[model samples]
Target: LSAGFDVADRCHLAPVGAAFLATTSSGVAAFDRNPGSSDATIVTSSMLPAYRGILLPLVYGPGTRSQRSATPPRLTHGPNETFIKAAGARSLAVLLDVLTRAGHVV
Candidate 1:
């Protein structure tokens, strides 16, 4: 149960050949601000060699405040619920793909 920031930091120190799947809502709202513009939430890090890192941005409802607020709102319900499930499914798929590429059967 690591925070997004923590996971991001640790990614730098992860062993070679390590695989990671992490989700975070941070910066998502800002990135999705433009109307009629949508980008894939799933991203892979290319800077980290020998590491397979997947980052899934969890979308929040419109008008949601920044996570840096003094009292950040909980995101376990409402429209976020859907995003959470989607992130989980994507994460699982990415994990399976990583394992398969490593010569492991799922």
Candidate 2:
């Protein structure tokens, strides 16, 4: 993430994007705040689809603090990026999904 993506400034992120990230990060942090809690107790279906199902195995929740996986999806702007030409809401939605997976706790 860029330095501008820092939640404090509200710089690079769209409003919804920032909110989603902030919320997700808080959830992760909450999990970290309590380590002895069983993983199953914290891994809830409310997680985004990217964080759900068998692939959930790929992520190891922090015991006492909120932490995200190493490689959450990213939304990049490039000539080949299809969503670039789409409507603003569409692109924003895609970007929000990426940020959500990245564990932004809005």
Candidate 3:
């Protein structure tokens, strides 16, 4: 169950095995299927030349079930223009990379 950050946030009803590609203030995040714990893990920011982004593992907790009804703070509100632009650029770069790998000229 892959989706954008917004869609992923609303996916509180998603199955336990589902994973999502979510964007964060610093970089990108992915839902991790850690059955033993509910806490999400944050991997150190990668300094590798091929990839340079924070790896945040978003895990579903008891609160996730009620997220649909709760008024969660949105990341799209005021004063997030810079982060939005950076996230967009990173998304585009990933898309282009995937396309290029598939033999499509970009």
Candidate 4:
């Protein structure tokens, strides 16, 4: 809904205060590249129970081209944002599909 969070840096995002939202891979890919090795995905299962069932974990398959990590990292600070990252093309495609199914993309 928002173009981008009003933060000093691209890394800074809005506080998650109970909002229904999902993100695409292209966005997280750029962030991962910018930070040069950061957790591509951050989930707060404890805080948001809905997230547990709603989110589809982005797994790095054989063709995934983005940076890979042993375990996806979680957000350290405030703001309940989820970052799902993987191969830009496939990940983004999945995001589009999810958004389409969610009736966000017309």
> Tens digits of per-residue lDDT for model 3 on 24-77?
223444443343322232222223423322232333332223223334532322
Candidate ordering by TM-score (highest first): 1, 3, 4, 2
**Residue by residue across 1-106, what tens digits does model 4's lDDT show?**
1111112242223222111123434343222212322232343223366654333333332224322342453332324323445344655675566556556677
Candidate 4 similarity to native, TM-score: 0.27
Error of 1 at 8 (Å): 12
Cα deviation in Å at residue 88, candidate 3? 0.7
Instruction: Report RMSD for candidate 4.
Output: 15.0
Model 3 has a clash total of 0
Candidate 3 runs further than 4 Å off = 2-72, 75-83
Tens digits of per-residue lDDT, candidate 2, 16-43, equal 4343445556453211222243344345
TM-score for every candidate vs. truth?
0.28, 0.20, 0.28, 0.27
On TM-score, the candidate that comes out on top is: 1
Model 4 scores a C-alpha lDDT of 0.35
Task: Tell me the deviation in Å of residue 27 in model 3.
Answer: 11
The residue pairs that clash in candidate 4, if any, are 16-80
Error of 3 at 6 (Å): 19
lDDT assessment of candidate 3: 0.34
Off by over 4 Å in 4: 1-42, 48-86
Mark the 10 consecutive residues where model 2 has the least summed lDDT: 55-64
Error of 2 at 79 (Å): 22
